[model samples]
Target: MKTLHDLHRPLGATGLMVSPLGLGTVKLGRDQGVKYPSGFTIPDDRDAANLLALAQELGINLIDTAPAYGHSEERLGKLLRGQRDNWIIVSKVGEEFESGQSRHDFSPQHTRFSVERSLKLLGTDCIDLVLVHSDGQDVEILKDTGVYETLDALKREGAIRAFGLSGKTVEGGLLALDKGDCAMVTYNLNEQSERQVIDHAATLGKAILIKKALASGHVCLDSGVDPVQASFELVFGHPGVASAIIGTINPLHLSHNVRVAVSVIQSRR
Candidate 1:
């Protein structure tokens, strides 16, 4: 089977090389009412760091994080420091936070604070990619607020290398594609609802990274092997997908994922 390590793909014409599969930090620092992997009772800072380092060594260049996911940005920053030149960091803004919980808010001030906070937590002068976590279905985008303006300002200042949107729905993804430079979406073998959005995002010459490519572990069930390998191949096979962010606490599993992607690439070749 192929793993991500062998598949050297460009990051949506950004000129950065990334594997088809990336290590997602969502579970490492997030326990926000969402079901997490077993034995992940709390933030294992050491384990998280080790896995992150391994991912980089295995050729996974992109690490996706968000402020909404607990201390995800902080821990990822800690692990990638000094080695920052070795990885591509992507963070999200526009999410409202309160009392260990968060909600999406596109207020201009909120956007500014989110970018600053992400920078502080990430411990970096510039993040490779910044995604605006959608406040809702693309409805709020219709409003004339400083959200887009704020993002443009950050880009102009070089605080962020590029900007995109982490959409919540198919409509949100399409709206983001129409209005933003990059579009973070969820599309897997089992679901094709976002197919049009993915295609359009490709046509826009914007970067399109796939999330939930394994259907958030749903595709792993009923299959004896790790679904990530299969999932990575599936998404990478699509024309618009540039990369797929995936989660794994086990270093061996991570390596297996890379191997699976490599095999897939070799098969196609």
Candidate 2:
């Protein structure tokens, strides 16, 4: 039997390798104000560097962050500078950020700027993959030739090793996954509405990663569940799911998350 640590696997039908588990930096860096609307606000940055180092040592290599995740990309880049070769950094486009209140930036110039800034902030020459982050609105711009064609050109220049979508809705998620290259992340399992999409991932050859599966840890408490197993395994059980992106601020919490991820993958076999 593969131990919990060994459950991390390569992405399906692609050369991209990842630990089936990943470390999300939103809590450690971007989170601000109370987490009332969400849950469990982030801790201070005292241990952000330490925890990230620990995650890397533990072989959790898919490090995810976004410009929308205020300070997350900068913090991660600061800690991970010069080690770009050892990690796969995934950033997002379509999110606009200026003076801390920004919206979607789908124009080719803005999209290009987003990638350039992400690369600069992360202290890397190239990004392993880039996803267009959606907040469940105005996604018609995605089908536009300008944004995608720009991304395709970046792939050719090797500025991005791959490209894909990260949608907030099933209509948008499925469209992006089917029409473009690579994967999409969405709210899965908790929403029965997404079941067909989850099932469809297996047949599509498109890598499907899940987010909010634990309902940001809300459903777990409400439904009398621990959330770790239910959320991780529910989506991961589907052959389509490549991984579930979860975030935390504490080292012990991250350790627990790693255990859950390992358990989910191991149980499937």
Candidate 3:
């Protein structure tokens, strides 16, 4: 069986190599206002540590987290500890979750503050990637705010390696790729509306990190079809997809996901 590390590839032209299966860390922090099909308790430190260890063992290097994910950043800081160099940490700015509510602020000031805070929280000097957490109005945020520009500045200053938008719309994804190194889009069996964005990224050598690739575990596959295998096949079938961020907290699910992802990727090759 191939480990995820065997499937690592360039993140567009960003110069950072990431696993085909990046682990999403939403369940490590906040639990409110999420759209998961079922509820899950936030894992304790020991459990979280075991999960990370399993991810590392499976050769997963890319990790996804954001300020909107509640205490995720801080928890990762503690859990990751001395193993920072073993993983590629991807955090985000613009969206903030607090008091059981979520809000957005894409101003340049907020963008800078968020990156700096993430650095402090994660106990790292430079983040591998940081993205703009768009609030539905992807095009407006990209054009109206100085957020992308601020991220560029931060990148040049060595606070972040690369930056882009975790966008909501096809237009926004295209625009983000036009100005940045990557764009996180929602693509899965249920959603192919962003295929244009993926094609565009492929043409431009920009990274496309897939969100909701399994439809947040709400997938309705045909009877007798294996949902995990089917989802991985659909996602990895795309030549432009750099990675799929699966946010599974269950260890068995994580291992199964990696195995399925490896099989799908290998079959494609």
Q: lDDT scores for all predictions?
A: 0.75, 0.70, 0.93
Q: Model 3 compared with the native: what TM-score?
A: 0.98
lDDT leaderboard ranking: 3, 1, 2
Query: lDDT by residue for model 2 over 1-269, one digit each (tens)?
Result: 22234556655555687767666667755545423245555555557768777787666878778888877888777788667777777788887555646677777888888888988888888887788877565257677636777887888888888777777666766676665655566554466565555566677776666666656555534566667777776777777777667666667767877777677677778
Whole-structure CA lDDT of model 2 = 0.70
The model with the greatest TM-score is 3
Tell me the spans in candidate 3 whose CA falls farther than 4 Å from its real position: none
RMSD per candidate (Å) reads 2.5, 2.8, 0.8
Q: Please report the candidate that would top lDDT against the real structure.
A: 3
What stretches of model 1 exceed 4 Å from their correct place? 1-6, 37-39, 142-144, 220-226
Residues 154-267 of candidate 1 have per-residue lDDT tens digits of 889988877778876777777766666778887887887878888887787767888777777667546585566567667767778888888777788788777777776677
Reference-based TM-score, model 2: 0.87
lDDT of 3 at 140: 92
| Clash statistics: count for each candidate | 11, 1, 0
Clashes of 3: 0
Q: lDDT of candidate 3?
A: 0.93
